[model samples]
Target: MNFNEVISNARDSLTVKRVYGDPYEKDGLTVIPAASVRGGAGGGSGHDEKGQEGGGGGFGVNARPAGAYVIKDGDVSWRPALDVNRLIAATGLAVIVYLISRPRMARARAKSSESPSES
Candidate 1:
């Protein structure tokens, strides 16, 4: 397909529908699944010394579950998606932060003990 067709196809496919799915109703609850979608398109055209023209384009997309909207009893609530990878990364970062600050905290504690006691 040509660049215009590719772009048009991409635009149609990459939209709110991709992010939000049809509402599911069961057990008196309505759940609308949502996702995070990101995409980009690039194209370029150039001419060689032989004056031949060539053009190319491509689209890339990344999607992940972001959250869902839950509706029940005329009330709505947002339920955020739990990404295991992100959770693990955050836990690792917290551990690293605590480990790095452990030394400083110990030094401060030592200095406070050395200083005269407050009245």
Candidate 2:
């Protein structure tokens, strides 16, 4: 397809409707699901020395759950998406940092308490 088609398709996929789903409502509660969107398009054209020409273009779109808006009793609030895997990784990293530092701290304490040799 041509670059124009690629760009047009990209625009359709990157619209707000794609990022924000239809609001769900029940019992006076409305939840609007939202997402993070990213897109890109690129094209290039070149001609060979033998008078042959070629061109190529492509587009990409990415969307992920960002969060949601909640409305109830005439009050609105936001609930953020939680990535459990990321949380676990961060916690593991912090624990590793603490464990790695504890040994050095103990050694430093021991060295400081030692009496220095004469001269």
Write down the TM-score of every candidate: 0.80, 0.81
* Residue-by-residue lDDT tens digits, candidate 2, 1-119: 87788888888888889888899999999999999899999988889999998888999888778899999999999998987888899999999999999999999998888878832
Clashes of each: 0, 0
- The prediction achieving the highest TM-score against the true structure is 2
Residue 103 of model 2, lDDT score? 94
lDDT of 2 at 63: 77
Tens digits of lDDT, candidate 1, 1-119: 56887798789879889999999999999999999999988777788999999988988899999999999999999999999999999999999999999999999998878847652
Off by over 4 Å in 2: 99-103, 114-119
Question: How many Å off is the CA of 98 in candidate 2?
Answer: 3.7
Q: List residue ranges in candidate 1 displaced over 4 A.
A: 104-119
Error of 1 at 66 (Å): 1.5
- In candidate 1, list every pair of residues with a backbone clash: none
* Model 2: lDDT of residue 36: 89
Candidate 1 vs. true structure, TM-score: 0.80
